[model samples]
Target: MTTPDVFMPRLPWDAVDPYPFYAARRREGDVVWDATAQAWLVLGHKVARNVLAAPHWISDPRANQAATAGRFFTADTVAANMLFTDGPTHDRLRHAVRDVFGHSFISQLTEGVESLCKQAISTIDVDEPFDVMSQIAWPLHVAVIAAWLGLDPAQCQVLREHSPAVIRLLSGITDTDTLHVGLAATTALITEFLPAAADRRAHPRDDLLSYLATAPELSLDEVVTTAILVAVAGHETTANLLGAALIRLITPTAEGTRLADHIDPADATVLTELLRLDSPVQAAARTATADQQLAGVHIRSGESVLVCIAAANRDPHVYPAPHQFLPGRPGPSPLTFGHGAHYCLGSALARLETSTALRHILERRPVLTATPAWRDTPAIRGPHHVPARFTA
Candidate 1:
């Protein structure tokens, strides 16, 4: 008789470097019981894709009792935003942003994006090791997103400072006080800025805010919420990706060198491969809308499933040498921006931003070298500090 598989104990390493843990689990099969988060961890390429694409999996935190129990999202203006909603509500709100964030619209911002990248890179000191996260990636992402959202430089700084806290709250990690402060900052900015922008757009202007303001059937609060969502979502995830990509570039590998040598930055395939090996957004939660069996595991209705994008990206079944940073590795794309109806509205913008920034870095500092003191955090996996010496 065949034996039932043994469940593994949850460890801190699972949070840190989940690739090895996921690889071990995937060996047993596509699905494994994750004791740490008390959810069925789906790891294989096909299973993960099915889970993400399935209509039965919902992104609304409110659908899961545990997800909404102590959250401040109930009080925040973000509650009106699409990120936390489902069904028609989500579709309508998402369309409002998606229209403006479409490929045709984002393509026009390439010059602005390239300018931001050049400006950020020009300021970096080539002779010394530097925190590229703070000096380059953060500023580039902030400037690009702010430009897209029609916020002035000063307001952009405010958003940048408060964004980490806001994202923490969204991730259900911050304390009540911290969450309140972040929410208040966001609300104040959106309330003040959106109305004026909306009014200007009604009269017609070139900026995105004007377009959003003039969009049919979208209300004032919807405009504000949409702008706020774009600013936060657009910047933070790409910022993380830039940092993670830099870490991969510094790692000793022939593939890394080849990636650095690729002159044309519009190569989405290479960037996608790098992202698959080292994904920025690690996990996203979804609640099952009904009792469903996924990859042989029974997922009850309303249970929260943490889709580990990082782990899934590295599934060996799909990606050979999955753990290695192979910039040219060919396979299915990673779920960094998610999939299906909820695919990131700002994905084109993000790709443009990252590719622009990386191209600038490579052109100027092709042989950048960093020290061994790079620190990786648990929740956000990237170099907290990347001390690098570059040749300009």
Candidate 2:
């Protein structure tokens, strides 16, 4: 296949309904080149999975000069982020906290997460329109992670206030003022907030901060950076997933009602299906370490590729009636949490939190009271406000 055969569609960075844009691009061909993004867009399920699982496709942006530009961070800081690293460095960083997100550890969090969900649900007034994202999902997620990290109320507050700034930094926004604020927020977290949390511990406690800060294998800088990653990634994706799940649950369609009533919160398959239908994290970026042929097209070394997880999840070849919300639909797992070595560490926790939260909310027999206003973060898709009311 030649370059001319590849479709180049305008990326819908600000589209309120962007799935159609993904569908439009996918219709042309799965492996299209986007001139605007200057990256190969992998919109098919098989191709996206193959790219994610391939060892030659690296996560490090430094390998590609174009991938490194427009970000405000120093090269060292970018390299320090495990999400952007590969090989032994990635393994060491991931292994440090791997067990923390395993089934045994996540199982222990179930009861506490359930209690937190119930407390959040109890605060909602019946028959009154309330933003579920703010009132329920966000608070519940923040509380869970804060407790997991053993952060005091003040430290948790600081995290809450500065998280958006950290998000801006991660989003690769090039606006001068925004980048300054983001840099300032990141610096404060590294130099002040995290250090304070570490200092509060006289000896290492059985918490995330203690583990990261006192680990023999990790340096102080590594501890601080990893902690920040934990704090930001810990709640954001799961909160967004919960918000999206709630929207689907509260839809007035007959299938929606059936799913709300019948879906088993503990059933991983059902939850997996939900994740496939409405993935929170949309796209993931990677750079080629060497020349490769992906889905029949040749990709040069140092070239970037954007794996469209949302599009892959809804690929008709993978899932029959791809757009419908079918809880028991059987197929290969979705790419919402990604694939291979870089699979999300907090996936188990996210699942436990989402399911536990949904179990409680479904008990109230909630319904949508108003249309949701979605956030414009194309990489991370979720509603900013989800107004809902409970019948029971």
Off by over 4 Å in 2: 1-15, 66-71, 171-178, 197-202, 254-258
The numbered model that scores best in lDDT is 2
Model 1 lDDT per residue over 213-267, tens place: 7777577777777777777767877887787676666555654454455435557
Q: What are the models' TM-scores?
A: 0.85, 0.91
- Candidate 2: global Cα-lDDT? 0.78
**Model 1 misses residue 207 by how many Å?**
1.7
Query: Least accurate stretch of 10 residues (summed lDDT) in model 2?
Result: 1-10
lDDT of each: 0.68, 0.78
Error of 1 at 94 (Å): 1.7
Q: Which portions of model 1 miss their true places by more than 4 Å? A: 1-16, 68-70, 75-79, 173-205, 253-266, 366-380
User: Please, what's the RMSD in Å of model 2?
Assistant: 4.7
